[model samples]
Target: MESFPTELGVLTCLMLLAASLWIPYIVGVNTAPAGSLPADAPDGFIRIPNPALHRPWVQRAWRAHLNLLEQGIPFAILVLLVDRVDGFTALTYWTAIAFFWLRVAHAIGYITGFARLPLRPLIFLGGWLCCLIMGYAVFAARMV
Candidate 1:
């Protein structure tokens, strides 16, 4: 009956919802004219031309979602480790918040073409740093 950090729970839900956010774009791209698919297309296939390959915004959203998943795995592990060892410290809590917000920002930026604003990379790096901080906190807690 051990309690998990609230931030971790919230972030987990956000990550799952973020993954689903790409569905609309995927559906839009895959919804095609009747008989327009290539002859090679499998019968009853839902997707025709790969959305990411054909649409820039869809590509951006797909990549952003993938990036979130990539980062989320490590973040989840570290968050759990930290919770098991030391519960949530001020540093861990704030870092988790920062990471979650940055991820949201990154997704929005990518989807709306704001990622080209020169701040997107910085936002991504910020999220990475948050993960690094959480990792260090977990390590430090374990050493005590």
Candidate 2:
């Protein structure tokens, strides 16, 4: 197996983590009792009257996955640009790792209903900081 850079490996792991968030959502939908579905649900489709109101955790899982996508796009672009333009530095590597861990925390907190009040936002900010740091590193490298 070819050894990949630590930064790249972290990025790959983040991607997988983002994908993993969907598991809870899919399972939640499939496992819900048929009787709980809306009476007007299509013959072959499972439909709830109001998923966000009735299935908050499922909504949380789905939103957590979406949040990852929203943040991951920019993070991925920055990491790739940094790697291609100036190579990964210690800052980039550590930032990537921090971002991954922060996201993990966010996802767990969100899905498990532990993301109360400031906690979730704090975790999100931490990940955003990591992205900012990495983005700055790329800009700084270009200035050198």
Candidate 3:
């Protein structure tokens, strides 16, 4: 087993993922109407009205969510490997948390569509920083 930092980092990443996915579910549920939807909903209970195809935020949110899911699996693998190796550090824990925050912020900002262009880039960079930091932690832990 690794130190407490690694354990905490793993849990943080998991929670972040949960939050990331949860937001979409919450949005769908809350946005959906009572009488608007069917009582005995069929296969696809919720039929979402696609926000707007041309908008960047609409595309960005969808893309970012998928990207998060994509990278998330690898993060899990790295964390498990770290635990198996019984290794990790402060930087690792913080980096994982930072990545999660960045992802969430990016999703929120982009999905809301208020902040455009430069602000979007800044948020995007936040997510990138998260990836870079987490990647470094995983590599550093492996070398230990």
Candidate 4:
């Protein structure tokens, strides 16, 4: 059996994390009060109120998911770029793992309201920095 690369494993974990972040928001929406037609509805149209507004946790969950998307996309791209260029290095490997865990912490903190003020932003910054480090590794590797 062939062993998978560590970075690839981290990438898979990150993707799974993104996939699961929507659960809380969806559950919150389903349990919230029923919605109604919009004020500007012209016919038999109906629109649900923004689910995020139904609860603070739901709102945080929604925002956390959004933040992941914003950060995850670039991280994914950079990871792939590194892989494509055979740019795997100690720095990239460690940073990839760090990025995945940081995202998990960020999501949990946001959804549960555990991390606040500077803490959440700092977690986000860590993930962003991981992406930058991976990107730089890719660039440096390609220059060789």
Candidate 5:
């Protein structure tokens, strides 16, 4: 079989990660104290107006998941756009791979409240830079 682009593979993993990141958030919520949610709450019910009410870890999980989605959506678009225009390059491959790992680390750091000040943000910034690199590469491909 022909080899597919590595960036697409990384994108697949990122997509799966984003889809499943909610697991920890939901688990944290369900295991929280009573009165967190209505007993007869419907499926897909999420009504937490005051996130402060939940455990700190739960809040982190929610935020981590949200951050993943925030980054994942844009990353997916850029990767697909680059691939669509046949803009595959060594830089794209490496950045896509780095972005995936950076996101994983970011999620762990966020959920565990590890290094909230500097390290965590730096990790996030790394992933953001990866996206920027891919975006720039795609734009540059148009000039070639």
Candidate 6:
């Protein structure tokens, strides 16, 4: 059976990739009006230049996406480990959801150039904590 966390994680990655086009699309739309641009006009109507366009912001976005993608492996591992121990529970769902959503927040932060704030670090630490919990859970299960 497919793992829910891993599946959602894939969707998350797709969201990141799809989101990248939005800026460019906005740029294109900005060139148009009422959903259509004049034939002679160049595309630039809806697109605002992202501060995230810089090397640092772009790298941040990519790194965050990769980080989330890396987490996908562990997501599967968690489920596999869970099966070897207890079945899925509400807490498991919450934890995984929190992790996935935080990475998404990180993506948003990076894309919007908000990753520099304390909020970014907070969200990051949340993801790390979720991973740590899963690690502890696996180890604790083996011990039990």
Question: Which portions of model 2 show Cα errors greater than 4 Å?
Answer: 1-3, 47-50
- Compare the candidates by lDDT and give the number of the best one: 5
- By lDDT rank, best first, the candidates go 5, 4, 2, 1, 3, 6
Give the whole-model CA lDDT for all candidates, comma-separated.
0.75, 0.82, 0.59, 0.84, 0.87, 0.58
RMSD of each candidate relative to the true structure: 3.2, 2.4, 5.5, 3.3, 3.3, 7.9
Identify the superior model by TM-score, candidate 2 or candidate 5.
2
| TM-score rank order | 2, 5, 4, 1, 3, 6
Better of 4 and 6 by TM-score: 4
Q: Give the per-residue Cα lDDT of candidate 6 at 39.
A: 49
Q: What are the TM-scores, per candidate, against the unseen true structure?
A: 0.79, 0.89, 0.57, 0.86, 0.87, 0.54
Candidate 4 residue-wise lDDT, 1-144, digit = tens: 966778988998898989889888877756655453235644432125364346688778889898999999899999999988988988888999899999999999999999998999999999989988988988998999
Relative to the true structure, candidate 6 reaches a TM of 0.54
**Which 10 successive residues of model 1 have the least lDDT summed?**
45-54
Superposed by TM-score, candidate 1 places the C-alpha of residue 134 at a distance from the truth, in angstroms, of 0.5
Candidate 1 lDDT tens digits, 62-137? 6777778888778878888887787578888888888888888888887778887579889988988988998899
The deviation in Å at residue 96 for candidate 4 is 0.7
- Native-to-model Cα distance after best TM-score fit, residue 26 in candidate 6, in Å: 16
Q: Kindly report the root-mean-square deviation of model 6 from the true structure over all alpha carbons.
A: 7.9
Per-residue C-alpha lDDT of model 2 across residues 1-144, encoded as one tens digit per residue: 965778888999989887777788878877877577667666655454345633678778888888899888789888998887765788888899989898888989988889888999999888889888988988888888
* Model 5 misplacement above 4 A: 34-50
Candidate 3 backbone collisions, by pair: none
CA error at residue 62 for candidate 1, angstroms:
1.2
Q: In model 5, what lDDT does residue 138 have?
A: 90
Give per-residue CA lDDT, model 5, range 1-144, as digits (tens): 978999999999999999999898878876767666656756655545344557788889989999999988999999999988889999998999899999999999999998488998899899889989989989988888
Q: Which prediction has the highest TM-score against the true structure?
A: 2
